[model samples]
Target: MLLLGLFSHLLSSGKFWTTRRTNASQHIDIRFVFVIFFLLKWSHAQGSHPPRIVEHPIDTTVPRHEPATLNCKAEGSPTPTIQWFKDGVPLKILPGSHRITLPAGGLFFLKNDEPSASLKIFSADKDGLELEVKGAAPTVLRDEFRLEPQNTRIAQGDTALLECAAPRGIPEPAVSWKKGGQKLDLDSTKRIRIVDGGNLAIQDARQSDEGQYQCIAKNPVGVRESVLATLKVHVKPFIIRGPHDQTVLEGSSVTFPCRVGGDPMPDVLWLRTASGGNMPLDRVSVLEDRSLRLERVTIADEGEYSCEADNVVGAISAMGTLTVFAPPKFIQRPISKSIELGADTSFECRASGNPRPTLFWTIKNNRTIVFPGAPPLDRFQSINTEEGHSILTLTNFQRTDRDLVVVCNAMNEVATITARAQLTLDSQEDRPPPIIIAGPVNQTLPVKSLATLQCKAIGLPNPTISWYRDGIPVHPNAKVNITAAGDLIISDLDRKEDQGLYTCVASSRTGKSTWSGYLRIEVPTNPNIKFYRAPEQTKCPNAPGQPTILNASANALTIV
Candidate 1:
């Protein structure tokens, strides 16, 4: 009962507690034991509250050689001791290392140091969160730093992408494009854009966009440039200067010049359609300047010529007209001929010229013949043939057609020529009387002087002439005789008897005709005799052994 009461008192005790020992000599204070147990359990609970970090040191990004900070916060009973570690090792504050440390028992920070460090926080009990410092430096690398699309060719209206290939760089480079040493207006030009702010893009490019392009990169690391890229905008061939209309003479050499222009140098070819077909280009030659040369061009070489230039984009051509000139020429000419009565006789004339010529025929006593109709004269026919061949035919030739002369005239815009021929008809009855072809004119002559008269006539069998004086037949005398050529000749004759009208008569199988004219004989006039007439002949002073000559006075001498 006493022990029970004691145990109950111990249980009921607030401040002190009692305990029993297994050995009597072993005496221990129950209050002391309870205090010792409470102390140990409190210690265990305090140790159980490890460093509970509510905020860990976060990663920070900073530029090189700049000030930055990393923060850390934690909680624990008995106040955890804060420390900093880098890369799993404790970090000690170094002298003059430009590092800042915060004063705190549960929160701390690092400042003014390189961000390259991987920081962490740890208490005396456990490790907290990991920390990171990101450091960046603006620098340009060597590789992948060139202008894209180097030496590229594109057509007009095509899109061009010109990029600065700077794949890896710090502080991202700003790309700018230039052409022909001039900056491009990326903001103003609607079709030109800076793609992703790193590449130059051109949409619907034209010939003006063809040039050397450069890409420039600028940043805090200074400026860097990429190699120049050639951008070519192809276009169809254009003929700036070429052969125009040309005029040249035949049998002469000629050259046609052409200039072709495009984005890329264009090739040129010459073609011509001339002289009934395409020109034999194999025989022709081309000069270094792309001029077509023809060695001795003829009239047949006149036609239209063309110069064509081609490239990958398209083709262009220009036309030139060639005019070759030649003088008029006769291929067939009119010829002289004689036809029997009621026979057909035709004359033909053919000519060639640069321009086709007009043909016409004209007769001596007939009307001219032209195109669109036959000969106007009866029994005459006009025929037109190919290649300027003209024919004039005379049918049933009559006496009127004898000794007829005809002419073939060919004329063009440049030249004119004519061919003439005579036509004769074989007819007898309808022929006129004997006609005199040639004769001598009648004139006065001195008495006792040699005189001759000629008469020429033409007939079928020829004609003879009869000489007459004063309308009387004259007999042949010693000084007067008739020649075989129907010529009357008198060596010496008396003026009174020989001076009279003269006539020539001609006869033919058809008829006879005579022509007369007065042929007066001239007489010599004597000088008048003086009143004191001297002797007819007088002798003057004579030389030795020489006969004396007498000077006859014309005024004093008279014929007996």
Candidate 2:
């Protein structure tokens, strides 16, 4: 089909030239005819067709300094020579030229300027065809900015948006953003991103995100930057160093340190939570360093306090407790008294302090005798009552105790104090010494059995009896019981722990007596036990067999 079309086109061209031919033109026409005959014979011999364009170059847009192509394909017997022309003039498309012709009659626009015009294509002895080729419009970007980002202010943890766009250009300008004169890497962080039309979006804005932002647009022709925009991030109040619980002495000064930070400097406030009011300005004041200072703090000022920091964004608070300690002071003193010999007398003492002082009694006449640690004297009893109150009683006073003095002491972590009272007797009475009538004797008991030791004493005044093992006091518990008659009883006695020397003590104000005895534990021995020696053998005749038990109990077992 291509061969027929080429032959027809050649005949038409010959006819056209003949109608307008002169003598010289006719001569050239005859040569043209011979060339056509030779082309037809070559086409038949090589089994080839005349040049025919299959695809033609179409209209297209190309950016400046960017590569592009205009395609044109043709077929022929001798591979027809393809030529390109613009505006009906042949185009000089050379090697290394910006506008160069392809091997198949296509035009290639290298990285350079492109022009829009009508393109013409022609093959050997073939009619020419025209197609429109166009370059990109607005190839050079304008100097003025198209869109600019404005100053943005947002709260922390909120999304921030900054919009930017480039001016019209042949090759659209690339848009980017920079912070504080440094290019922002959108791929390095997940919080910042470039969105629609090169707009910048920052999620979860933080304090570090506050800076000057600028948008940049660049193309082959030129580059432009938007006006610098400042980003302000509002942060809530945060406490860096808050108040802490502390203890201070009364009448002393103390300071509670507080430090806070925020975008809009937060205000600090000190409050007493116990009284549900602000700190009394009379003695307490807030220093320039944001610390609460209290001068000469008293017990009444000891309570829970709060340090509050507030800003436009939010508010926060911290609590601390102040503990004030005071030294011991006596509120009541014991009065001196005189009593008949052998008659009981009592003295009462009381004191007060910030920490509820401890009250105890001591005899100050001859030597210091601390109550609860005094020797066994039933006649002299010292009782501690409710809340800093104590009572000291002297019963059956003897002649040698006439000029004795009783002392009451109060103490706490802060300080200690003492008060003394003199006791005078009208007349002295003689008292008999303490004597042990019945005492514990040495005895042996079996394991897991019960045992009891007896101790009885007599004196002018009833004596107090106490039991001990190897000088260690024995207190009553579930397994050990001390009866009113001074008898020590032990149940479920252990073989190893319950064997020791026991002592009994009987004491009174005048004198004292003691009796000691040893306790032994008996353990039952196995009945079926015997001692034997086995002869040492150098070699064994047979291997030992597995043993089997015939009888078994908790204590012993038999195996064969």
Candidate 3:
């Protein structure tokens, strides 16, 4: 009871207390507490307090030749004594070392001459309770690079990251970047910045950003420059010059110019726009200059064409139109034929052209025959067949229609062509006198009015026909012509030369027939029709209608 009372009195007076020490020196304090516990043979009481730390030594860093300090402080009853240790060994101020213990339970180094060291603090009172604090040594740097940026590639308008790191140093190295030997200014642009332990990041990378890059680390110890790295910025594909519209003749060659620009060279292809089909490998080729070439183009090859360019970045296309033309060509031609009296005969002509073709017929004199107009004597007709074909038919063949010629003309924007054919009478054993079957009559027509006269004749053997106007041999022209059946037609009749006598003659080896007609042109007045003024005759007019035989044979005759 007396011993317990004495322990209580000591605890109440705060003479008995416990102290805490750093992990490194904790065992020293624990043994001291055990020795006190065994000597007193008593337990601690609530009236006294355990040694509690008010300040603890913390981790520290300093220059190689500079002084350093680690702060530590504690409080307890009966004032604790502070002690220092290193690596579980009691620390003491050696003769040559600058390390020493501080009065405030801290550690201090007058000069940091060693590479690295750690210090721990212990504080205890006479009762053997303890407390602790610990501190770390200064840090040092390394000599070699740990990581470096590497070559990289990225497309434009995308993010790019380049990693870099420097070796540890007394004063940490400063990381920077260089492009094409020029220093990168991170503060000047928001698109570029440093991150993730000295890694370079570029947002919305552009073509100008492509170049050799390097990572630089600088310190008092040394300077480090990473290996040169390449940064490639790719651009989307685009067309500079595209194909153009073209018009060419069939069987000719054509070319389409295609020029493109990109980071990497783009590939070009020619495609048919309508069908989206690939170009024909046999006739179409891509040139070294990136132009498209087509050899021996045809009508079927005409259409919308497109040239497409593509690369790893993107694709582009351009379009143009192609036109092909063909000249007129004859598919079927007129052929000469022989027909019997009163028999019908026809001539056919067919042609082909790119724009189709128009057809027309011409008579023996090469005078174009007006279409859809009734033949003077209802003995001739012209018919249009298919797109580019025509036919000329003769009805009720007569002797005067012998030795007739006809031609078929096909025309288009490209060219014009004609096919010619002749008609002859079949052989007949009996020969008879030529007689007139139809005769022309006199008529007075208005000026500029069309006039036509018919004169038909027949004989055992067909007869040759001829015409004369006002004592002169009638010449067929654009305004006048003689039909195969011995007829005459006058268009846009003028009073000056067309108002005169017209005569028709049919002749054969046996005999001859004749007919005459007068076309008097009159100008219509308000009240009465007046005859067109005629030139006065100096002397008697020659008999132009008189027939003169140019050539004669046993079965035929040609007259002028």
Candidate 4:
């Protein structure tokens, strides 16, 4: 009974043990299954996940006529899909879709859908249809900027305007004004005012304000400057006189009248040359009409004269000139007449003037004559000048050289004066004539003989004509021969003792002329004599009856 109870307790214990073990096993199995499920879920969560989309930018701001480009991008598991939208509406990718489709992802180009669109907005559409839109503000770009009244002139105590404007700009820029490299503040002054849009008004300009004014424009991105404008101011002074230029003859008195006009009568001071040549008050007199008078003008008076009018504001001046002139003058000797051939003549023409003078000579007739031709003879003869004097010399005067005139002219800067003289030739009768004469007055000759004689004459008239012997004119007589053109004659030869001196004379009304020569006569001798005899044994060379007698003296002789 005890053993049976033990066994039964063991069995019960065993059953309890078995039940706990089975429970533990079941818990372990459930844990094992849960671990495998967690692992699978973690693995699936770590694999290739889709990327998340973030910021998207699209440019919608562009000019009305300009094209625009939109940038679309996405962050996704495999780069999430991207698309474009217009005016908050999805853009369809199809033909005839007014909203044109572009390549997806990085860049998207689009035209301004509405040609007149202004202030439009563009957006990027994601695959989830998420919209990211932004608006672009229209900008104005400035092109040209300039200033009005670029240059101006204003009188003292007068107002002038300097205006500035811009043609086109992205933003309305601020305009500022500067004067002489310094900024001009906006204020209402007694003589200046700054107006809107960079306009400066000179309420009352003065000489001090005459300078350059510049306008500058300022903007967010850049700064632009314009040309500087010049401003001139004019003020009146006291005295005004002219010829403002004056010309006066040398050694003459001149008066320069200074007329004064101004608010207050200002004393006039004459200044020669701007530097140091100022005329003293005593040298210049102030007339009742406010005229500046100069007593006598000299060459020193020729220069710039400043007539200054002085007051509190400043001193204003006017300029004038005084000129002195010297007239031309001539100093020369007169031309004189002269006679005689191969003689030297002189004429003097000296001129003195402001400017030197020129001298020249001219002939009247067309006759061709030698140089220094027949001075005061045969018409007029022009003599050339060496410097300012004319010289003439006639070489050998003939009776034909008469009634000529020599002229000399002296010319100065202003005028020309001529002096002339006439030539009177000496009478021809006062000259002596040459003399001529002939010789062999007369001669006697023997019968049947030869005679030679000659006659020559000399005279100033070159005497001509017949020869004479014993006052009888001789010619070529046949019995009494003459030769050498009747100057010599020869009679028949008769005897040897007939030679004598003969006289010949020639005469002209101008003078006596004479000449002479000798005449010679010659006669021939008797004929030659000869003897001839007959041969008688070569004897009886002188036999009285057999001998021959010859006489050549006889005109006729006999020979035996």
Question: Which residue pairs in candidate 2 collide?
Answer: 138-169, 138-170, 139-170
lDDT of 3 by residue, 296-367 (tens): 987778888888888776788999898877887889999877677789998988888777778878786536
lDDT of 1 by residue, 1-560 (tens): 33234334544554331222221111111110100000112233424443444554443333334455545555555455555544345556676655556654221223332323322222111223222222222133233464454776777887888766653444566778788878888778799888765777889989788899887776554566677899888876789888788877777788888888886678898888666557756557889889888778887778888998988777889888988876678998998775666788889889888777888787767765545256446776666777568888877888677777888888877788988987765444445556554343465666677666666565544667777777798667898888776666777856787767777778866577676656566555534422221111124232244322221121221111
- All candidates' TM-scores? 0.46, 0.43, 0.44, 0.29
Predicted model with the maximum lDDT:
2
State how far residue 214 of model 3 sits from its true place (Å): 9.9
Query: Which window of ten consecutive residues has the lowest lDDT sum in model 2?
Result: 25-34
Candidate 1 TM-score over all chains jointly:
0.46
- Give the better candidate number (1 or 3) by lDDT: 3
Cα-based RMSD of candidate 1: 23.2
Q: What is the C-alpha RMSD, rounded to one decimal, of candidate 3?
A: 21.6
Q: Provide the lDDT at 420 for model 1.
A: 91
Q: TM-score winner among the candidates?
A: 1
RMSD of each: 23.2, 25.9, 21.6, 32.3
Model 2, 109-217: lDDT tens digits are: 6764534433222234433322222222223455567689999888789899999886665367889999999999998899999899778999999989999999999
Error of 2 at 352 (Å): 1.5
Candidate 1: stretches off by over 4 Å: 1-150, 155-185, 194-200, 203-229, 233-237, 260-267, 274-290, 310-315, 428-560
lDDT, model 3, position 48: 45
Off by over 4 Å in 4: 1-127, 146-149, 180-182, 187-198, 238-560
